[model samples]
Target: MRIAFIILLTLFYSCRGVSQSFEGAWKGDLAVPTGSLPLHFSLQKGDTWTGTMRSPSQTRLDFKLNVIEVAGDSIHLQSAALGMSYKGRISADGEHVEGTFRQGNYTAPLRLGRYDSTQTVKRPQEPVAPFPYNVKEVTFENTASEVTLAGTLTQPKAPGKYPALILVSGSGPQNRNSELEGHKPFEVLADYLTRQGVVVLRYDDRGVAQSTGNFLQSNIGDFSRDALAGLRFLKAQATVDSTRVGMIGHSEGGLISLLLAGQHAPDLKFIVSLAGPSLPIDSLMVLQLYHVGKSQGMSEKQLAKVRPINRKNFEVVKSDLPAPKAMTQLLENMKSVGGASGTLRKELQVMLLEPYRYFMRIDPVPFIQKINIPLYAAFGEKDVQVPAKENQESLVANLAGNPQSRIKTYANLNHLLQPAKTGGLQEYYTIETTIDPTLLKDIADWIKGL
Candidate 1:
């Protein structure tokens, strides 16, 4: 598994004795759906004013753009990476700036005040070690489309064929390492499992890493084909014990794993889920938005509006209407409620629009129940990404009569199987560690038992 490269550009600005119009540090806050978050805009004069802007406490939010754009009292910054944009006016003192934050279908008026840049600067975490395994980077064709897939095969270092397991990544355009927030869970897991005498195979999702395909164009069903192809690759490997082969999926990967086991059931021995969603994804996302809004203290009346507006935007995508038009209508509904007290309209708006089209149609029950393989599911109680209760409840409810299925719940762990403090997104960025060793242990024990 290869780690993704970090793009860090150090931009230099010219300082003049005669002095330029806009220079020095600019501090402010951007209003979000939940509340206002601090934004640090460090500007230096040259051809253009530029500097990196970070959120308060260095919240690991995906900003639209880190570069600062200054035009006299008017400041314009856009983060294409995060699909967010900001436009505001800087105070005459250059110490404060107030503007509107725009993301997809939502917009909010944001205010910011000047602050010292010397305040404690928090650094990011170290990358995790790759799972102990003999590795091979390979590429092959997608028989259906004849498109080549880039992937890595991590096997036990010792000789002799071993039970092989295919690793499936979670949501988003993930590479072979399953990199997220500077953590490479696939490498960590590959290393852990291989050392324990299991041969593992993990590949890049199409359109990510060296693989080929359009991520935005593909849906969950398309991803399942990729997983099956990976499995096929493993079965063809001379060093793998095909009879004992299985699948391990995390988050979205877990859902895919169930699909593979259910439909193909291709000599698969077992399956494992790490923090995967078992409920309908739309419902889960609604719960996420509601939880986030409540965490920021939205009142009952405000929440009432939040739910339906959220549901309409999310559910409408699955309707007969076109996705783009459905999304547009959803945004309008959100704007109608944006003025409500304590509601983060822009955040909800953006949140509702992008992920809605991808997740609204995903229902994992059909796949989960149809799977003939022995299933093992694990979730961290503190996980906010996939609510612990929702994941466990739905998985259990689906497998209620299936005695062969096993489920375990871990307390104080986050989505990545790391020990967590309430498992909030902030902790994911601030706290540094690969994953909890205990999680690895649980996985190994379960596999061995199976």
Candidate 2:
């Protein structure tokens, strides 16, 4: 995990009224048009504030907004770490705040209010780099598609043809930077790998950064195509040893890597599955649903009722019926099978519906069984997005009949390969840093051995 820099962190220091008491631990939900998410605001006197957000499922984590600018009752924060900026206003009593979060022209209104602090505390001492990676970034074109893929291709300073790896981001329209909060994991990985005598190709996904395409409208299949295109791009490069080219995929990217391996691409040499799931899409999605509900303190009985509804609704949406009609009915049934009366229900609805449909419609088994490449699958035991046991077990079982697959489960690493306590996403924001160095070493060593 590369430590992204804080461009600004002062709470309205640039504005008047330097005496307001926006100096306590404030917590609330960021109420968006689609749903609500837990937003934590920790304020320190002298114009310093840190913000962290968690998804409804509480698995995906975001970063703490650096350089918070608060003016009187208004707050302005810009996270260059994520190339995002936000502006909102708080009530005089420090009770409520409403503002818009902006990334380029994409903007969304966020509502946050004060709350009681939980037992969770920030761990500033956790192991992480004090500064982000230092590397040269470059851009190249996809000759076949005419799409420009921006990347930071890092190589060892010494002149030599090094083994190369392409870094593929997980779900979401990620830039080549893999900008999580403000941290750029891909940039950091490229630098670290290059320093270890491994060349790395980290590029923007389609529809993100300098790449051309509509990322929001893309699916796993489209992402897979993009990954294949990346592999081809790397293979054609004069500096990259075509036979030594491999892929390092995170989260959904890991699953795609499995599919790529299964396809048995002739140029592919190795694959690293980081927190990838082997189970069917529907089953994995249901597990995600349950995990999110549990994090929000849902009761066992409530989960029992909600779980079946989730699985069934997804099944209905994936049926051969028309998509528009199926989606309409799915929403109706979700509304009927309700949970407690509050923000959680709305959040859960968003969590259960979108990704469930996305994953269920595709199957990776056919692809998983057909691969002839050297396979490496690993997971953080603490990962909540795709639990270690369920994801790795199914993956191992599929590879059980295939003798070439190798698997490892890290006990203390999170989805980002960061050394973590319980490996939860919350730790990502609360702890300042990139992933553990050992994990990086493990990856570098594995690539070298190949």
Candidate 3:
């Protein structure tokens, strides 16, 4: 599953040349019940006022402001796509912008000051170079998709023919490091595993930084082909033992691994799944919605009210109808159900996109039951995105015939395997730990043992 950031932006009052003063960078801390989220805004005065916003704690990419307007002493910024807006007034000294940030049902006070370079989030587990291993920048092609993927490959310095792993990222357009919330989990995983004498290759998703192809137009099957291309490239390397190469995937990546293994892809000896689903996609998403909503402090009554609507929406997407027809049916169902706000309608429209529609129809149990190779699956106990208990049970039941398969769940860990409290998406930015240390060791040990 992907974690999306809804970010807000702000401009400055145009009267008295205040807008010119705001043409530079500004920063702010948005206070929420979980913790503070750091946001940055960069405004530029061109033919027309233009600006971009970033939430450094959640994502590194800047979101372009869709609307920027100034009315008297007040300034407003809005992004219809992200469902976010900010309204604030410029201070007398033109040094501060006091505003309220709104995204969906969440709103909080925000006060922006001059950008400070020193204030940055710390990720202790992110690897730094000192040269114990040989790292290479590599590229490969998926002939089926006509995409060239780029990535980093790390290997032991004393590399002979050794066991190799291809790291597959979760959903969304991610770089080679699988970066999120200012943390690079894939880099750390590659570093630790390479240090343990394994060859690791992690790559950018198609159309993500340094890669070619349109990420938005791709689905899980297309990604699985891309991963197969990676496996083919790794097997061709002289330093890798062709029979000993395998895949290690996280979230959606994990599902991709399962797909390949079930299909009995060549040279893919084993697989590891991190928070991959074993149940049907529709059921899994419904559970995810319930758990995530509860973790965000929604009342049980409120959750109960939306549960049926969500089920109906998923059912519409899962149907075999054409895309346009399914979307029309979905809209009619929501209208009949009532209470769906304009914001929710927009979000539902996103579900009609090919990616979500394909995802909702997947039944991973069939794939899980088909796997005969050695497999290892891990889940975080506190992972609301892919809850452990139900998925674990489904996997165990489906993989019963595969005695070589192993499944584990770590306590107090969130979706990213960080030790967490509530395991809410907002808390992911606040937690300094990237991937839990114990889980990292466990993964390496399991792969090496195989």
Candidate 4:
């Protein structure tokens, strides 16, 4: 599941009275407890100074600076959509900007220097061309949603019927590769599995790149229908063994897999849930807030004060009241949070969105308990986003009826399945490995055995 309120730092500069031009590229690394998060900015000076900032380690999209101000030697930049801001002082040499990055209550030191285009993050596991598999760009219609979904189909070159898997991405706007944090996880996984003689199909989420739909307006049920459409399309392929078809979901996708299987989707023989939750979503979210906040250096005292408020806010979200009423209750509940007014308002805006409201009301334990198909669920021991222990225990207890199910947790792995030190989100960009080799092998082996 996507952590809705988390914000990454960005770059900022002043256009007035500086010896050197701040119109080119600037780069910085925000130092956090886990590691450094690289941020980039491309600034342009014209009739009005305009700039765009990129968080390379988190996402490739550039956020437009909503506000930029200059006072003496101080530079301040803000992005209202991101709930992020930066304040810095330009070095006398004009080659560096030292600043403090703030997002909500979190703050960290950021030092930016003139960017060199030659330096780029390396992702060793991303597959290159000249593969031993056949790749084809395909499109299918989710007639139920009237959305034309696009995806990639990879099959072994040997051309024999193989066990098929449809990859479902986590919450957020994702392409066929499920790209994030400068990493294309679904692309790498599809390549690995296809090379292992399995037919793999990975699609862009509805309203994402190459797909047609309104993403922000859609909910989880809409995505589940889209995945079902992919499954039907895969089963019709000549190189796929329809009886052996299954789904491999990550995060929210994992919850979708359980939902489909619990409803007994046709021709779906097995499922693999990576960092999927089996607990009530409200409880899971509260746990997520606690763990992620602690990992980001939130004190015990602060966390204690925030916990009950968050729970009450979630209760408001899950209620049957209309949106306006729900939002009023959410705001009233947040009065106790007592943070910066701007930050509180930004966070309330997210909670009032349709997706957050629907997600908070869902309890996946009932769906997990109803599944009888072969299931393989894995978690990262260091994953703060999902908090491995409690989720794993819930899955273990609820899935006892399914004797074909298996659950395992890998030590030192994060939500993305990369080997990590602190399991914090910042580490996702720094870690070079896309997915753990062992986990890949485990997934392939389990599916083939089934």
Which candidate ranks first by lDDT, i.e. highest? 4
TM-score of 4: 0.81
**Model 1 RMSD in angstroms:** 8.7
Q: Least accurate stretch of 10 residues (summed lDDT) in model 2?
A: 1-10
Best by TM-score: 4
Worst 10 residues of 1 by lDDT: 1-10
Candidate 1 residue pairs that clash: 28-112, 29-112, 33-344, 64-79, 65-79, 131-191, 132-191
Counting clashing residue pairs in each candidate, in order, gives 7, 15, 0, 0
The TM-scores, one per candidate, come to: 0.72, 0.70, 0.80, 0.81
In order, the Cα lDDT scores of the candidates are 0.64, 0.63, 0.78, 0.80
- Candidate 2: stretches off by over 4 Å: 1-136, 142-146, 335-358, 400-404
**Residue 250 lDDT in model 2?**
85
Candidate 3 local distance difference test against the native: 0.78
- lDDT for model 1 comes to 0.64
- Tell me the tens digit of each residue's lDDT in model 4 across 128-180: 99998899999999998899999999998885789999999987667788777
- The C-alpha RMSD in Å for every predicted model, in order, reads 8.7, 9.0, 7.6, 6.8
Which portions of model 3 show Cα errors greater than 4 Å?
3-41, 44-118
Sorted on lDDT, best first, the list reads 4, 3, 1, 2
Clashing pairs in 4: none
Model 3, C-alpha of 132: deviation from truth (Å): 0.3
lDDT of 1 by residue, 1-450 (tens): 000000000001111122124455655444332123345555565775555555432234434346566655676777666577778766555555556777676565565655565655332223245545567899866777555678777777667878789898876666787765456778778877877888888777776657888664566677777777777888888888777788899887887777676675666778888887788866776776665454445566666665775666557655656645664665566565433222233333433333334556768788777766678888988776677887798788776344566788898887777787766655654556667788788788777666
